[model samples]
Target: MQPNKIKIKNYQLNSNLMLAPMAGITDTVLRSIVRSMDKDCLLVTEMLSSEALVNNPNAKILESNENESPLAFQLSGHKPHIMAKAAKIIENKADFIDINMGCPVKKVVCGGDGSALMKTPQLASDIVKAIKDHVNKPVTVKFRLGWTLDTKNFVEFGKLMEESGADAITLHARTRSQMYADKADWAEISKLVNEVKIPIYANGDITNIKNAIECLNLSKANGLAIGRGALGNPFLFKQLEHYFNTGEILPEQSLKEKIETLKEHLNCEIAHRGEENGIKFFRKFYPYYIKGIRGGGAYRGKLVTEDNYNNIINLLDEIIENEQKILHIHSAN
Candidate 1:
């Protein structure tokens, strides 16, 4: 059965599913696409450095659109003062402020932020408290299980966040040392659910509908936050929602549906970043969407060499046309 939708602060999410704030992946264009597919789910912006929010020319990247209501901004920093200032700047523009304590990147950890904050409970609490004091909207924290294997501290850390005035917490069930390598330890998340009164969202390797259901059941979390699962499959939100609401498994993606969705995603990226940089930015995603298909490697090779938007679009068109022909032949056989 679908779990009851819960309130964070003034905003009530219609579903328990959320989009995890991936660093380079979840931008305005991707959030808009996800919103179109499932309007009820909460979407988060990519993680912005608190320093960058204050000093960088790319501050506009953190701004939320009017159409993208119920959106949250994820900020990463080590200093409480900087986090507080950044939260104040975003409070007027975002529905909620999220502190990123889960990023395991070396650059982030070396700066005493991200997963490194996990090792410093007092500092993490201070950062959360500082942001809470500055923002009227709900304050959320996203963090990993611990800094490393020997220092798994999320249970105590979660209690500290609640004590510090965070409205909710999302636990990515992996230590900083694991770095997306090992399977996510949902058992630790279950411990967090048992310990904290605040809403706990479980995040990890939730790749599909079945995995999402299993994570919710195993972790007993209030909600599930999906990350890599939505890479080429924005439809995942709708699929999980439908299953949760009605106990029905949605049909798998048809070849035509896959092709159309990829095209739509490419168009959204192009519209947001413009032709030149958009195409460059999108090169990383080609392998993800076209993996395991015949001639996919060849198509990816051509995609990398092409700079002109027309050529890229033409290549995608040719690939899609050929894929359709192959599907037709298989169906006839």
Candidate 2:
């Protein structure tokens, strides 16, 4: 598989794979884990509200590790001036500044932000232009196909973004009304790619190397911006890297390896977010790591509610022991 080099402004990213910015999930700890897996894969910070960041520049979400470079700091807002100001504040810290125009959450849309911007192309273009004028780093926009099926204007939107000085664009390939419910229309991404000259990264429903290859073949995208698919699978980026570079698929992580990685992820979260909140925050991830294992549902049920760190560790250890026993039994038979 031939790879694409994502070029924005003067920066040329080593790999085309991007760890898409996910609200509340792509924090320092998660980025650290993904970074450890593939050093060159692009990492994005969770969406930051321009107003909130302007008011509180020292917010914890702004905190980042040293190695998470080639990182894009994503901002969500409608006001061009405020968005540009926020970009200015983080420009020194970020390799690229990304604007979030694809989020479909009602709270965000009601504020004329996120997917709401898709309906207001003029304003979205202004936001891009403003950020471009203020920051030396590359400016990118992430958006959906449109607000609804009747208004799937992504091709026009992509051209407008390019005219307004957007260095790149990421298409989520779904109408705002869909809200992640149905399949993403990769055909729309193909349309956008045909219309825009700036690199367009396809972003939706890509979970593995197979999906990655299918998406690239279908959309002709320069790269992939993966979000939810990477939730508990930190090794995904490296796996994709290996396949792309060598045309060889790496074996999936064994049960023991998954358990040990989960333990490391937990400890990192605890160190970054402190014990109580970290343990609680980690609940959202237990199901992803234990997804296909036998007795996983029951373990996930207990893990989500268990706030005691030691107990969580013990339960994880128990899972490994049980899996070993099951393997032994199967071998004997």
**Which candidate tops TM-score?**
2
List lDDT for all candidates, in order: 0.86, 0.91
Choose the strongest candidate by lDDT.
2
Question: Candidate 1: where is the Cα deviation over 4 Å?
Answer: none
Residue-by-residue lDDT tens digits, candidate 2, 166-268: 9988899889999998988776688888877888889999998888998998989999989988877888888998888889999988988988889998999
TM-score of each: 0.96, 0.98
Would you list the clashing residue pairs of candidate 2?
none
Model 2: weakest 10-residue lDDT segment is 1-10
Superposing every Cα of model 2 onto the true structure, what RMSD results? 0.9
Mark the regions of model 2 whose C-alpha exceeds 4 Å error after superposition: none
| Candidate 1 C-alpha error for residue 318, in Å | 2.3
> Model 2 misses residue 81 by how many Å?
0.7
